[model samples]
Target: MNSPYSQKIVQPDISLTICGYSKVLEIVSNKWTGLVIYAMEDGIIRYGDMRRRIEGISKKMLTQTLRQLERDGLVNRKITPAVPPIVEYSLSGLGESLLVPMKALNQWTKENYSQVELARENYDRINSGE
Candidate 1:
């Protein structure tokens, strides 16, 4: 019962391509990465405001994530000369392209989270001999 998607995945080149592309997955694999991306979805936002929007993330973590995103060309950072030297962040064109798929994943998570939780619980129970 191999569908087109599965069949394509079976191809050697396609499998290698996916392996190569997994780096992109690692870039966004952290919990904070997606939240940071979503926080900037509307438009440019100040660093302080972004920090506030993404609760529980430490300043160090935010700074690290933003730096990584900028380095990857997925986010743009701007600095304004001021008393405090204001810093702003926004999604780059690449980041904007990533948002469409991210939003789809978010929606999928919202829709299927219960099923995921159930599966996790079942797995844990079975593994624990409960």
Candidate 2:
């Protein structure tokens, strides 16, 4: 009954343990989080700029996601004293490290998305006939 895909999701030792895996997934599982992280990758990003860059994100959701990322130490929030009290965001050291893997995953997704969609279509067609 053993299958490669059924293997343990998290290793007991090294890299991502069960708890670590859960946390990582919890953060990256949300589409908004990944988009937010990607938005901050180049350099410090302003809240308004982020909204413009990430199309379809609501103001509330972006705010919520940023707060979560700041709480997780994955992003740094900077507030500058100004007329409106300018707010900006940037990736923390921890967040910067995550990009190495995230970028690789992005590349993989870009390369295989078509294949994945085809698989899904085939699977749906076969199952629907049953």
Query: Evaluated with TM-score, which candidate comes out highest?
Result: 2
TM-score of each: 0.83, 0.84
Cα RMSD for predicted model 2:
4.5
- Model 1 worst lDDT run, 10 consecutive residues: 8-17
Clashes of each: 0, 0
Model 2 lDDT tens row, 1-107? 88966877674444444578676788788889999999999999999999999999999999999999999999999999999999999999999999988999999
Best by lDDT: 2
| Candidate 2 residue runs with Cα over 4 Å from true position | 1-19
lDDT of 1 at 99: 94
Total residue pair clashes for candidate 1: 0
Q: Write the per-residue lDDT of candidate 1 for residues 1-130, one digit (tens) a residue.
A: 8576664454355453467568778888988999999999999999999999998999999999999999999999999999999999999999999999889999999999999999999999889964
Clash list (residue pairs), candidate 2: none
